[model samples]
Target: MISRMFSRFNISIGSVTHQIFKKPTSLSRSVIARKFCNEIARPENFATAGTMNDVHIKMMERIGLEPGYSPIPRSREHLIQYQPSSADLPPRSMADSFTSAVIPLSSSKSLQDLYVSYLGHVRFGRLMQDMDLFAVWVCHQHVNIPNLDKNIHLPYTFVTIMVDKIDFTDFSPKGTSDIRLSGHVSWVGKSSMEIVVWLEQEFEGTYKKITRALFLMAARNATNTGPAPVNQISPGNEHEQNILIGGEERKKRRIDHQKMSLLKVVPSNYEQSIMHDIFTRITRKDTIQLDKRVLPANGKWMADCSIMNTIPCFPEHRNAHNKVFGGFIMKIALENSWVCAYLHAKSRPKLETISDISFEKPVDVSSFLQMNAYVTYTEMNFMVVMVVADVLNPTGGRMTSNVLYYVWKCNESVPEVIPGSYHEMMWYLMGRRKLNYALGLTSGV
Candidate 1:
């Protein structure tokens, strides 16, 4: 069964057009095949080897993960002696950490084919994955500041904890346009830095903005798994100052939201908030239609949704810290959510925005990961899917690892998701807030 699933991948892997990175033209098909075979040939037990399977490899390829890939080494051996000291912070310029990468969104045939299954548009999930990956690299560069204690640079690992203020002004660059993804360290804290990333498409002569996002990453010490100090970013100009200010404001908002989320009860002011009003109005008896049959409901709640998909996490999909990459998790979550959206809407789902995604805990490698996606709410020409990923433990317990909120525009013929119970109603209201927040973000609220 596994071989059958990998049959297509085997063919694609051997093709010369499958080049993910620059390789020697003289590299033979046999060499490529051998490399792939070696990747999958490991200890029989996944718990022991954490080898990636066919599903993991295919998904990684769709999101630009090259097999047998190794990044350029940055650290030089014996460059400086390691020492421990608590001293003044090393200040760094934003330019020192700025990084930009350009890719032809349409010129790459492999990429185009990978996006073919995405309703004729470049997969939003893949684009998001690249954004996260690039942002992580930018943060990594910022944290690699020279150590005051030693001549060597501080070896720090970073992980993306939050993503926000995402505004995709235009559709993804699909055809022949080249997209330049740029990231810079905009603001810095004791152990965290705000990396702002922008995606632009090169039009006839000028570069047009496609999407912009903010990623919050925290630095972890190499020796101890604790917060590590990051270099302070000094703005060079007025524009840089403005960007830094924006990052600071967003950081405050993130802290505020985190605190609010932990509150056992909603604050008194929340009762007067727009979301509270929306929830109250939608849940009223007079506003709801009782006799009208919402198409596709069939009077059975279970028949109206999708089944759960469970997969195992593997080492090949992990980041530098051995934790699963956020991009990989996002891809699986989006795909599963898209399935639920398509089944309910009976139409192609075009992604609008990944409103919010919270990583509650790191998904342990070799753990059974289960994803559940359901259409929480549907309005005119739009649908919201809430996809949750949980890690199932050996003791038959489960812990929530991720919660993703997605928004998509659907076909007109698709019916709205009618809430059948109080629990579903709460989800419906939450969906409304998610959509509203996405719109506000686009409008620069």
Candidate 2:
């Protein structure tokens, strides 16, 4: 029955062999790919604004730092050669990178106020920001740069390239239970590492699983100039070895999925048939005019179901390198997408999965960030929301910085979303592919 449901999508589920990397004699394909992507997808450089307001002052005070304090290092006197070889670094075990932190939501009312939504439930979007931060911390734990400055930031900067997947089993979090976040580096290539994080809540002296996230991060030079080599990791035991293997499979799947993107390839016969069926149901046979189309009883036009927001990127949300944090951008995007899903579903939707989020460019502080989110597709109780974030310039130009995709499930069935144009139809198909991969109906393209 499950297979039949996905037959029209032309999807097949399967697995491939895991490729483990030993100490490399030369640069690997992954490293070369990363370099090529970075060259073409370089972020626009914006001069840092010196404007400081009352809000900025307060934030600085709260963090026990002065307004003039910059997290960026003042000097590179601690000399280290650029682009170190991967084989030069020593191998570390997964256990060496394991890190954990507890959010004392149950004990601190002040903290709870920041995390709890008006609906009296923990905000999943805020949790996503924390998870992203935690994933970077885990990567730091795995990195062992010899003789680097201990007081200053590491000679390398770890940035999130992709959020492969975030799956939620239990979205509800009680205010009385403390939330714990833990993870380790599951896989490593020369210039990339995969960090797997777990979100759990305490109940009756036990930790119950809530969700698991896989983050793919790439290392760059401290100056944000180019790709930097990362240390290699070896599995310590059987379970850890299994995790390493899984990471390899995910990497392969990501490559395959990109190659099969709708922009790069035409739709298959099965997908075309499905799209035709949708068109037939929405249009009247008596007329050829698109204006004469009639929507299904519970259908909504995709164009009418969108939401947009403009936000000022402040320095308070900036990372150590002084750029707006990727995690902060993610939190903002998720909340906007969640609201779009709610309006489309006519009910509070639960986040089922974050299939993929790509950070194409770095967002600078003191810039205006704009986000547009809309419901692209729906099936039964599931909704696929896409959020596109761009940086706005004073000249009225826009540069796309990030694209995020989310899968949400509601308690009841949602209104079917109908595509009104060719672009929207492509978005519909892309959403379907994301949903299929998230539900394990497909092994990915």
- Runs of candidate 1 with Cα error greater than 4 angstroms are 1-88, 104-120, 147-154, 175-177, 202-206, 267-303, 411-414, 441-445
- Deviation from native of the Cα of residue 406 in model 2, angstroms: 1.3
TM-score for each candidate, following the candidate numbering: 0.69, 0.83
Relative to the true structure, candidate 2 reaches a TM of 0.83
lDDT of 1 by residue, 259-291 (tens): 644233343343234234333433435545544
Which residue pairs does candidate 2 place in steric collision? Answer: none
CA-RMSD of model 1: 17.2
Please give, for residues 1-445, the per-residue lDDT of candidate 2 as tens digits. 4344454443322211112223234545444433332221111331111211222343233223444535463443342353357766788877777767777787778878988888677788778888887887777778886655444445666789989867788647776568887777888988899988778888889887788788899987766667788888776665566667666767887898889999899887766766777777777878878667777787899998899999998777886457788889999999999999998888989999898999998988878999999899887789999999999998889999999999999988788888987799999999988887777555444
**Counting only residues 3 or more apart in sequence or on different chains, how many pairs clash (N, Cα, C under 3 Å) in candidate 1?**
0
The number of clashing residue pairs in each candidate reads 0, 0
Clashing pairs in model 1? none
lDDT of each: 0.61, 0.75
